[model samples]
Target: AQTVTQSQPEMSVQEAETVTLSCTYDTSESDYYLFWYKQPPSRQMILVIRQEAYKQQNATENRFSVNFQKAAKSFSLKISDSQLGDAAMYFCAYRSAKTDKLIFGTGTRLQVFP
Candidate 1:
């Protein structure tokens, strides 16, 4: 069984600052995918970033970037220049190439202080 773990239940960041949310996973398969999904108050699941198991380079999308450590099975999200809109529930998700279902972490609530 594969699972994603988010040790931090909550995190706070000041506006225009940066914060890193930690995540770890346990999986047996060598080939898989990792994702960070943001669920805003609207409850829509939005893709923040994604990283492939085979890709050594980390993924980045504007303010969002990932620190993917395949050997340690760790994938963390860094939000640079955070804004109030960044405040949301961030879920770390894992998906295998074999399945369409994504297993998600408990999630971390990011609060952006104005």
Candidate 2:
């Protein structure tokens, strides 16, 4: 069984600052996918970023980037120049290319102080 771990249950950052949320997973499969999803208080799950196991390069989306260490099974999200809009519950998720259901970590609550 695979499981995702998020050490930080809560985090805070000032507006325009950066924050790094840590995540790790236990999985035996080599070809799997990892994702970061954001849910504002509304509770809608939105895909933030994704990384494929075979890719050596990290994934970047505008102000968001991922530090993917495949060997360590660690995937962390870095929010650069954060904003108030970035304040939300960030969830680290994993999905096997061979499976459909998404396995999510507990969650990290991000608070952006303006």
Candidate 3:
């Protein structure tokens, strides 16, 4: 069984500031994929970034980046240059390559204020 955990239920950040969201996952599989998705009021799940378990380098996209520690089974997201548009619900997801089954965490609500 695989499960994802988002320790932070809610996070607030001021515009232009940076914030990091903590996420940890438990899985026995060695080959898998980790992802961070953001859903705003529009209710659409947008892919923020992704990482492969075998990859040593962390994944990054624009202002979003991930700190992936395969040994600790931890994957946290860092959002730089926070903006009001960044305010939304962020979800940590995991997918096993063998089963292709995706599991998601409860999510962390991020509030961006000016």
Q: What is each predicted model's overall lDDT from 0 to 1? A: 0.96, 0.96, 0.97
Per-residue lDDT value at 92 in model 2: 100
Backbone clash count for every predicted candidate, in the order shown? 0, 0, 0
- Over 1-114, each residue of candidate 3 has an lDDT whose tens digit, in order, gives 999999999999999999999999998899999999999999999999999999999999999999999999999999999999999999999999999999999999999999
What ranking of all candidate models by lDDT puts the best one first? 3, 1, 2
**Superposition TM-score, candidate 2 onto the true structure:** 0.98
lDDT of 2 by residue, 1-114 (tens): 889999999999999999999999998888899999999999999999999999999999999999999999999999999999999999999998777658999999999999
Q: In model 1, how large is the Cα lDDT of residue 59?
A: 98
> Estimated TM-score per prediction?
0.98, 0.98, 0.99
| Candidate 1 error regions (>4 Å) | none
Clash list (residue pairs), candidate 1: none
Error of 3 at 38 (Å): 0.2
Residue 100, candidate 3: C-alpha displacement in angstroms:
0.5
Candidate 1: lDDT over CA atoms? 0.96
Q: What lDDT, from 0 to 1, does candidate 3 have? A: 0.97
State which candidate has the highest TM-score: 3
